[model samples]
Target: MRPVVFDGQFGWLHPAAGPHGVVLCYPFGYDALCTYRGMRRLAERLAARGIAVLRFDYPGTGDSAGDASEPGRWRAWIDSITKAVALLRQSTGVERVSLCGLRLGGTLAALAAQQLGDVDGLVLLSPVLSGKNYQRELRAGYRQWLSMPAAMDCTPEPDTDEFVEAYGFRLYREALENLRAVDLRRDAAAPARRVLMLDSLDAARVDALAAHYREQGIEVERRGFDEYSKFMMESLDSEIPRAAFESVENWLAAGSGELATAARDADTHLSADDPQGHAVEAGVTETPVWIDGGRMFGIYCMPHASLVTTGGTPAVLMVNTGAVSRIGNARLGVRFARRLARQGIASLRVDLGGLGDSQPSLDTVTLDALYAQDGANDAACAARWLAARGHPGVVLLGICAGAYVGLYAGSREPAVTGAVLVNLQKFTWRNICDETGKPTVRVAAIGSTRSYLRSMCEPRKWLRVVKGQTGGWPVARELAARCASRLRATLADRIERITGLELGASEERRPFAALDARGVPTRLLYGVLDDGVEELEKYFGVRGARLRRLRRVKVSFREHMDHAILSASAQENVMSYFEDFYRSQFGEQPGAVADEPADSRDAGRSGRRARAAQWLARQARAFRLSGEA
Candidate 1:
């Protein structure tokens, strides 16, 4: 499958060498993110079954171009489905096109079928019939989430009539009103086509939806398929619903027409010159590549620059941010990479060793097990690969844990000339002791309870405190534990230094200290509301004096932005920082470098930690068990 652009939408095209084609629409918000891998797997499966498949992000979502927070996002998304179907036909020369969607995606598919008379079939999985009901569920989920201990650090805004946030997504009044008016059960007249409705929760709504289609003289089939959640859940181990997907394949095959021999002739290559994966814009190319000895996957982006191509364009490497894949939160990586390409720069947004497409099943270590270690190795490998591709002066850029990894990687790799670390929580991760006395590596939670408590000192937060909306005991216990942990580490470091003995390697392996010593120029960017701000002050001395004195480190902040940089405007702010960093790092003329042997260190995780770190495989699945942002 390859990336494609039509109108202003971004999608992946899976050529099947078949006559039938499918357009897979994804669900909205975090659901779409969590189900991204599953969607891709399903598309590949359908393609193998002799059906051309196109899965894409709607306008304002994923790598697609638009502001999701805007009022008309729903209408734009519905229109995007038609464009996708048309593009699939035009690209593959397929005579028939079908729509397959999950959750809200299914609802949008039904809406698209209503608008476009050419749709041949519909596959709706856990489709939302009533937009009002879905909105209620979203609000409830948001409220339930806010009640969790992990949410205590985040501030809640006053109830508003104009807007509301849920599961890291926002809904404006206009969008809410538009959705509330969606009731396919009563308002939608089914298109004349075969329809398959599969329900994971065994809800009566699917049955009703099917009946409505049948009443409209459309052939409808309904099935109870509860395993679909496995395909949409947040866990990396979550596999595509094999039985459910096979059922869809069989149903589609039942109506299969003459096969298209030209489908196999379609182009889907990873070369910079390949035009198959051009982004929505006219001058940007998106190439999917497998690097790091073919153990890692990434998308390389560069400007067309047909007028004047250069071999020495500066490159940027963006690692996976948290567990949100290489796209970064809110598809920040894609937007930034494409923008940089237009400025005569190249970028590679890659999934880390065991995150996103680089599944744990493909490797011995899971994301959590490799999080604190493999970053340096993976990033160094990426830098070397970029160097070989002619863009030798590479800058490392990442957010959250990605930031931590970039810092360590840039410090260790000679190819990395500069670094942009955003919302860096900690310089070192913790190693927990197991029963066998061996250490197990794991990512540490960011910020402290005391920092959260101090944040509550704001007048607005005090109002919430007075209203008793806070969980007092959990906060107190967490605060005490964090203070105790810090004190213990401080005393341990002092004792080890005075006695000339090693207590632990955590304090000894500070990446900032090493980066500062090397005089590597680094930029630190943080969101105003991010907890990492507190971590920055605690680790880098008062006002970051320890690093600022190096005269190579710079710090800046984005106002009204959260830790994840979810909003479009916030993402734009992030892009600006990326542009400035790349310009400053790679603006100079080319320089000759000395040829030297690469580091001989083992790039994989150490075996000593592997046995003890077994539990981390499960921990990475419940990735935010300790923290969300």
Candidate 2:
């Protein structure tokens, strides 16, 4: 790796041998050094094709200097990236410069490209189009924390400040405010800049932004990828997929003539079917719409069926994995959203603050880095996104972790009218055993050591010693203690202090308290064969109907569906229940079509009763074989 520093922003710059020009690459969030490995491979591949690559980090992110918590740091970060691009041109003696960015970096690159006229081409991989949603996510997150009774006392629990997760940096308000001002739509049209947009399934907002560029007569090409590459969130043996690299390489190799033709052709298709195309109902075409959350990078779908003419549709905002992009979950969320949309009910599929093409994970960095509060944030963001697009009512339809986030967010945010928790895990004790089947308590201990040391090393160390020891075990028990004691010692207290923020049995029970206090409507659905079903039932019982207003049901599926809505059979069953629930609540629309009419009719006639009988049969079979309950 060729380590290079430009204006205090450090990164690796790979120069092509007798290069055609330089391409500056910016990665999402705290993924500075790690991002380069993929770009380096691309650089070499592109260099062989005659292009140099420059990859760097913004200040306060990655290995770059400055605290990410400072005000106006995002602008400064953009400025730093722009400067680095210039430096690459100067250092490489190249006249033309191409810019490439992933997620928020893509938005930043577009903004910078607008200001820097020297840019030749721009490659935006899932660019965030709004910043306001990103801010709402931050506020919603704070609300989630505050909503947890006595959770936000504002008293600093020692070493509970910093957290790092797969998403990115974990600064509370600092990153949030900075990200709230970025607007890619405003900067979409860069004069004389050739733009290439790479999208996965969740590219509605970005595609819309790209369409704006095309309308401005800017050269733009949009490419869709089939696979989900978690390069930004996790370190893989390979970073950028071969297909993505090949596509970009082909686009670059063709030169301006082919590029211009490609752009025009792509724009032609985009215009014909406006990337944000709405579902057709009753021979009327509705525009699929998105609500921008300013700099916060929150984007939500607003279906046309929810219009007043549709007699007020029942809506659901689908939530998914914190680490996975909204695009990756599109197969499930889109399927459900379309199904709901087809039923004369609306569904808003939202990209949580940091995930997807919304914004850098730094923008809404959570304390646990999991957006432990994102479910609430997502609910609020979805509502805001919907209200902005003129939808009056919305609910939550979440699966697995998405269900948890939706439930948490729905409880805190009033915008959520209702929530459907599918395959919920009320209380989970994951990582119980290591690969060798040994208890993982020791491993957890070692992981907590670093936190422990940080707390002890603080100025008021002696005064905080008791807090440190009590908190230390949360970390120590979470990691493998067999690792270096030094590593264990380093994380000990900090891990405890941070883990201390976690909702214990009592704290976890508070949502039920808030539900009782607020009287929110909730529906909990679980597969009986699924793990943790008993625990979830207990949770619902503990919270009780007063707070939760919960109606719980256990689906009698013979096989366990491992969370992702992966099985077609499982998906069909879940969708059927969702459609029925939505229809019952919102009433049927004039000309809404059912995706699975045969299944719907069959389900309506005898599905539930038949499933019940099957469950009984299984129970009888087990009893006869084992002679036990």
Candidate 3:
């Protein structure tokens, strides 16, 4: 699979083992965010099964060129599918192409297939049968998530037909209007010669839709997809629905005949004014490059005019936040990177090995592994990649798990002179399990404690507690825990002041101390009420005030900034801070100089050897810190 950009969109083109290929249409909004990795896995599975695949981001979303505020996104999404189909056919020389879509993706695929008029096959996995109902679902999901502990307070948008939103993604008036009038069964035609529809447990709509297609003389094989519930979970832990995915693979394989082996997938690279980069927007060109000996992937967003001479401006290196990929939790990485490019600064948003599009080196990659120093090694590799390409320095910035990796990478990589850690939850790992037997993210576990605290402040909830309806033990337990943590921090601070040694809840301070020792400028940002704030207070005092002793390290909290940076306004706030920081660190504007030639062999032996040593060193330190804690 290779990254290809066409029509101002980012897509992956999987070379065909045979002549048949398929275009995968993924879900929209929050569904799109959760199903990203699952969709990528599906495409790989189909490609491995002798069918080529092209999976892409729509123009206004993901790593694509536009913003969600742009109008006509509904048509833009459907048209994106149409263009992807043409690209697949042109590049892979596959005359027989099929469409596989999940949720709203299914709706778009069917519509695209109808537009194409000669699609070979279609696979719809629980597609939205009505736009009206989907809007309701989106609202319900938004409300539910808004109540989660990680959710932050913000002024609410008006409830009107002009907009529909959930989980930081929104549909403009134009898109909402389109969905409002949509009745797939009535408006859409039977899109392919062979159709396979996988429906959810609710079968009424699926049956009716199948019957409607049958009325048009189309053969439809519709079945229950009980695995849907598990498959469409949050990206961090979404299980691949092997049963459903295999069902599609077998269905497509059953009808596939002789297939051509020649592939045009490699030759469709976007040519820019500078042959080295692909122009993704007005002044910025995004080139997808492989790092760590092609074992990891990253998108290099560069300003065409920014010249990188010796000791040039430090490029920004971004890593995955949890398992959501380099696009960031809410596609924040893409927006931020492009904004930086426009400011004459280059940025690389990367997927470390085993996360995002990066190849998983282990048989099973756990969240623990994602937060390990090995991930920091991947970030170090990206920094080196940037360095060899004339960027001798980098400012590593990341959120959540990425923040932890950034701090570790900065500690080891001399080129990383500056770091920005956002909403960092953990500095040390101790594999604790939740009730479900999965290694619990500290943020999730801490959320309950915060919720119980808030309940005491709520009149209704407190009244119930007085009536013995709500348990007091839980509240008392939570308060005791909070008091104990604060006492420990207070004691640790006094001990450190008396002697040069740290104690109690002080493990989280080691990374910052390491960065400070090297005089590496670092900034830490957290939401005022983020779960990580407790850890911050435990280590550095309220709002990280005690960090003044660390001359190079500064911490600040944002108003209503959620841990995930889920909202557009919150994202903008971070971007604004970054821009100010960049200007202060670099200059008002970087003066253009002659471009230096890129390294001949970035993934060469010497580079790999250096990266390996760095990884080993960092991992040793990490192990020591964990042992000490």
Candidate 4:
């Protein structure tokens, strides 16, 4: 599968020539993000089974070219499905096309099939039968997430009458209204010649939808989506329902012709040279690039023809946030990149080697490769890409694990002129690889664990802790020990700062010291009670006061902060801060790097990295099917 863009929507095209092609419609909002990797695996399977497939992000979502707040997004979403169907047919030259969708995507698929009037088949897996009911579920889910004791400190206030949220994604008022109006039972023609329905929670709605299809004399096959609960979840642990997928594949394959070997052979080594970007907005364009020799992937968003184009302004580099891909949690990365473009800055958001669209699974990647101190080689590739693209330098921004990667990569990469760290949990990670070469990943405490511990004062919380609610009691003990060392560490930090020298061993100050030598401006933002702040207080005084000793270091603690930028207000807060920060540092008239010719040396380095990456991309790598926890 290769990345593609059509009608300003980004998608992966699993190319093959067969009697049938598939357009896999993704559910809206966070569900789409959760199922991203699984959907990719499905597409790969379908393609291997001799069926071409195009799985896409709807407009205003994912890697597509728009913002979530735009009015009439629901209409645009339906239209996007229609567009995807056409693109798949045109690209694959298959007379028959099937629409397979999960959750809200399933709803969209049925609707789009009806619109097309000639779709061969429709598969709805745990689909939303009624828009109004789906909206109610969203509200319920939002309430449950907020009510969790662990989320109390970071809970967001949603307007009871106005807001509809799904984890980090929220629907706008008009869009919510549009969603409520979708009632599939109301005299809609059967969407396709044949239909497969995978029912999960709401049997009544599924039965109603099935009856509606039967009324129109459409052949319908209804089955239980037995694995739905585990399959539809946060990506890291979301199971890929292999049995459910097999049923759909068999159904689609029953009447489909074999894929033409000639066409399949022709697709080898897809010409991945930076595809031209469609206009994102009036002055900005986003081109999807397979950089690092095609071994890595990123969406390069650039600001065009800016009066703010001052020399020496660096582009921005956004890495994966935690285990999430290039889009970032709640699509903050895409939102922020476009926001920067409006401010006359360019940015590239990359999925590091083992995350996002990048091939290797997190299960296979060593802890040392992604989370540890010296594990930012992939980001180094992106920085080099930016430098060769004519950017004098780049500013690295990351949240969570990303922050750790950015801080280390920025300090080391010569082209990095600035670094932005948000809710950085730990300054270092412990890596222990086994003799078999597969790293035994010893992950540090994530925010959820810390949140659980913070509430351990309660008896119920202590019971849960004792029962090993935190994976194991050993982790809890380790956290307690770290907490206890704070006083000694803080005292040591004070002595070292006053003397302008290391007290004994190097601490968090090492990276900043290196960055300081290169005149890199570093900014650290944190929530008041965040786990990362404890380290800051221990090493640089409470709220990073002694951080001032490193002339280039600046820190901010915001009241409306969450470990993940989950809420609308939190996202607004971070974007506003970055805007002001950029203007203050780069001046209002500053410009990002441009597409000027790269020096031979810089080009050579970029070329080598790109070549290596591309070569790696050529090797056949298998994707997860059943999934692992």
Candidate 5:
């Protein structure tokens, strides 16, 4: 995967040996984040078939420079498609080009094709047909969330007169107006020779749109696809849509003779200013690195200007939160990293071994790998790597299971002067049962059982529990287990206090206490009504006072946020917490610079390799220091 800068936006290119190239335009906000890994996988599958492909974040989104605060972003997104098309054509020598867009991206692609009159073919996956209809759908989702049992404890809803915020981003009044105007049924059919539209989960919305295109003399094929919701819904472990991918592959494989000739002719008319007809700031730059002897993969984000100037090595290391990859839930880490870069603070968001692009660790597979056992080891390696590369004051940041890892990893690594733990689900390591029957682990729903217990307070769930469908013994056993667990924790705390040293609860066995002793500036944020909060109280007394009593440990109840931090308003709370933590713990720094092309490749390689070696050495030293070697 090659990261590129086009029209001041960040995108990844998968080069293929085929003559045709495709550009993948993603949907906006949370949908884009949820489907990122799936999209990346789709790109790889296409590339493997000898078709070069490009997947990009629209302007003010993903790893890009601007954000939702920027006005006229709706228009900018439409123009971005044109820029992406040009980029794919120029980067690869492919004579033919096709556009594949999901949701709003599909709409933008059609609009761009109309303007450029260059695209050879189009593929729309779950394309949004009418903006007004989409908005209503979003509003319906919001209402459903509001009525959920968990919403009772959420922070009071924020008042937004001009915008509707959801899934960590908002669409303004003007944007909604733009959406209302985007009725593809009314627009003239794009000049593409063939079009393929996949309806998500048999919503049956695209049939009429495709019929409209067919009436306009356009070749349109519409298919009902069930995996659309599976791909676009949020999950730690995303299941890539094999059927949909295969369909797209089969369609693209059927070639047209005019495709190449038309593509070449269109390339001749392309210019830098052709897309938006204005210059854009190339803000943050990314360098992909392979660490831990090439077993771990990460992307280092630096401000463009920081390339030339020598300064303090300040950076944040963000780990994969659950199975959601390095971008964090809803691309939160990406936005956080770019924001830090803009403030001259470098950050690395890495996929711990066996996740995303990172290779699996020895003795483990993707589905069964134990995250808690080796998370500290991986994070420690990451911290040491940053330290070796001149970043001395590194902060470890993670969410959910990633937070659990950061707590242990940051406690052990001196380079990690601070740590941010968001919505940590559990303190103890629990092995997940898999088909292999070998001890294995991935991101576990540790607090989900507690959530289920809370749900029993409702009469309907209680009825189910009493019925044979749920089994009464299982519920009773769960209650008994919770009581026993709390009893054990209470005894353990008492034993530690009496002996002045943990008896059975050693540093390795007890992460929270160890973290407190290490005196690292730690911030723990949990959702207001998250079941994890009850888990916290169970282990550390009411409000987690056992940990909060420590001078360096801080805890907060984040309002109006789910455990996943899925909403824009919730994300703002997370971002504000981090910004405050950085300022308080590390002080201020200069604004970061944009990309300097000369050093990005070579610098990243040598730096990553050297850091990998140092990390290994550091691990050896740590083992020796602890007498574990």
Candidate 6:
């Protein structure tokens, strides 16, 4: 095992024989730390075939320096990998390089390959094709968290960046926005070479994409890996798909002697505790920020360079669930912050109270209590945090229930300049079972007329009698008994009363109405296929025409793309839209922007383009509905 540093860009490098060549490997987030079975196996196989392999971590991800909340560093990540490739060539005397990536890494590799005039091959494993799809999945997960009953007691301080739950790390709005702007296929056009694509039998989209690549005359070959666990989710252990690895080895072994000989002689490597060599910079000052009366806490990411200023930069504050920290969210947040920073924009990903590293004070309140109060205090607390930082012009960006909080905050705070609500929801009901083994709606019922008459119209007395008498096998059975006793009762009336009260209370708060009056640009992003769309729309009166100037986007790509914006293709497309929107509104300036070339790789690629086009078309329809087009 050889540890190599290419001009301060650290990575794990495996050498191969014959003509020196390079293969850059990129891992999905979290997957970078937990498992590298597939990556390590591929590196060994390629190294044996004379292809040197190099894999490194993105800053604030594995072992790299800086915080994930710094959105201005995404380009830095791409630059680091590109520089690593160049350094690998200098270190090994390799004249040719092949880029290999898994998931988001595939998208990043594709982007890097497009800019570098390297004469080589490219391999993408289930690359993210759409950003909107990934965001949708993220939104869904957040909505699920919000729907849980108050008994779960899962609530983070509003405006904080971190959360702690059963799972490892959870990312918030900053991360989601950053991931939303990453796309690989947009400008990824490399010279046709031996392109190998691996797909799972169950992955119909990947299979279709592979077929499309083959038709493009790109020398593409598709190999199916059966029964391999998904590498994205943390649920899978670090187990290599041996069958898939061997297939790749066989394919490379059939290539030219230079490639084949290297494959046979390369060193066999083990999955290391940390393969990316990510290290934090020392002596970095960490400033603490308060949210929800110190119930939630966050660390501010200050600029490292003198040229980077906090002045006049549009600030974005993020919100997340109780499963991850601001740092995890920074994985995505840092990307956007970096991009925006390059454009003279600033952002902050806060740790909500009671989650991650943030410990609530005695006076700090819980999310359940805040929800009961319609999130007013929580929103004000976030606004005050920004105001103290001299960031008066702020944008409220949230995911899932975070969206709810953002809406609530934006509605109340006049300092808010804009609002980005992703996957918003109104109300969530918990399933309650009756003694008869059937699902029953849970609501407060009013006393019956007969009971009232018997009690001489004493409502309190009747209520006590019902509470004492209603015990038993099933709620329905008890209700029937009450009805038999000449008590007036109906599910519809009770439901109506509950719904009216909830809505009436919400309206009385006047948060959304205030936001509209404030003219704060509000952008609501959601998945067209999101199950919660109808539910969310029902509560927050559909702002049909209002969303146009506000810039709403509905991602319609893959049906299953989650909210994290994990899909490679979706990531690329969504980033394109994001960049376009940001540039259009913020004014594009030289040096403040990076030019991304048009990805013509799929120009001649027959089937993939057709399928992608169809998928994009469907997404386009959804975007049009939101007036994004």
User: Where does candidate 4 stray beyond 4 Å?
Assistant: 148-151, 259-274, 360-369, 372-375, 432-483, 497-508, 538-541, 544-548, 588-629
On lDDT, the leading prediction is 3
Residue-pair clashes per candidate: 0, 50, 1, 5, 9, 64
**Residues 492-553 of candidate 2: C-alpha lDDT, one tens digit per residue:** 42344467432224555565445445644555554433433334423322112111222222
1-629, model 3: which lDDT tens digit per residue? 77877888888888876878899887886678777788888887777777899999988888888987887788999999999999998988886889999998888898888888889899999998777788888888878877777774433446777677677788778887787787766667768998999988448988988889899999889988988987777777777788888899899887787544434444443332223467777888888877765678888899867444334688999889887878886678998898888878899999998877878622234676767789888898889888877875798988988898998898888778788888888778765655453675543434624445665678997788779886777557766877687667666666777896756545666777888888777888776567786777666654454565676777666665666888766787678877766666666543211111123123234577765764465346322221100
Please provide TM-scores, in order, for all candidate models, with all chains considered together.
0.72, 0.41, 0.87, 0.83, 0.77, 0.40
Which candidate should be chosen as best, given TM-score against the real structure?
A: 3
- Tell me how far candidate 1 lies from the true structure as C-alpha RMSD in angstroms: 10.7
What does candidate 5 score on TM?
A: 0.77
From the highest TM-score down, the ranking of the candidates is 3, 4, 5, 1, 2, 6
Better of 5 and 6 by lDDT: 5
Candidate 4 structure quality by residue, lDDT tens digits, 1-629:
67778888988888876778899999877787777777877887888888889998988899888877787787788899999988888877888999999998888788888888899989999887666778888888878877663245665775665657787887778777766777776624678999999887899888988988898899999999898887777655567788999999888887575554324633433344636777878888888887766677888888886534757468899998766778888899998998898878889999888677775533333345558553487887799899988888888888878899988898889989887788787775666666643456634344433355556657875677568774556666766766566556657666775776665336677888889889887888776556676666556654554565666776766655667777666677677766666665676534421111234114436767775654343222101101000
| Per-residue accuracy of model 5 over 1-629 as CA lDDT, tens digit each | 55577767877787776788889988877677667667777887777677888898788777665776678988898888888888888888888888898888888887877777777788988888877778877676666766564453445356564777555467778778888887676553654878998886325557777777788778888887788777776644445778988999888867533223222211222221222211224556666666776667677777666442365755899998777667676678878787777777888898887665566412123323435558778988988878887876788888877888898888778888888888887676656756753345444323444455556678986687657556667557766776676667666666666775554434333665566677677777776666676577567643453553365676666556677676656678777877777776666432211111223223436777765764465345422221101
Tens digit of per-residue lDDT, candidate 6, span 1-629: 34454443435667665464556556545545333435655675677666667776665563345544466555766677678787678766776677777766766776777777564676766566665675454445555544432111123224333321112234445555556675433355442366777756236656655555566556777766563454443312234556766766666555534453453312333222223322134312223444454455443444444434444444666654323334433254444544454544445666555333344311122334324334434555666667666764776666555676677777777667766665454343343544542336533242222222334455775566578864334534544654442211223223444674322224423554566577665555554434334343333322221122222222122222234333333234334544553444344441221222123223335577675774465345543333232
lDDT score, candidate 2, position 9: 65
Which pairs clash inside model 3?
Answer: 19-259
Cα miss at 156, model 4 (Å)? 2.5
Q: Which candidate, 2 or 5, would have the higher lDDT against the true structure?
A: 5
**Candidate 5: Cα lDDT at 443:** 42
Model 4 RMSD in Å is 11.7
Off by over 4 Å in 2: 1-292, 296-310, 328-330, 361-367, 388-390, 426-506, 516-519, 537-560, 588-629
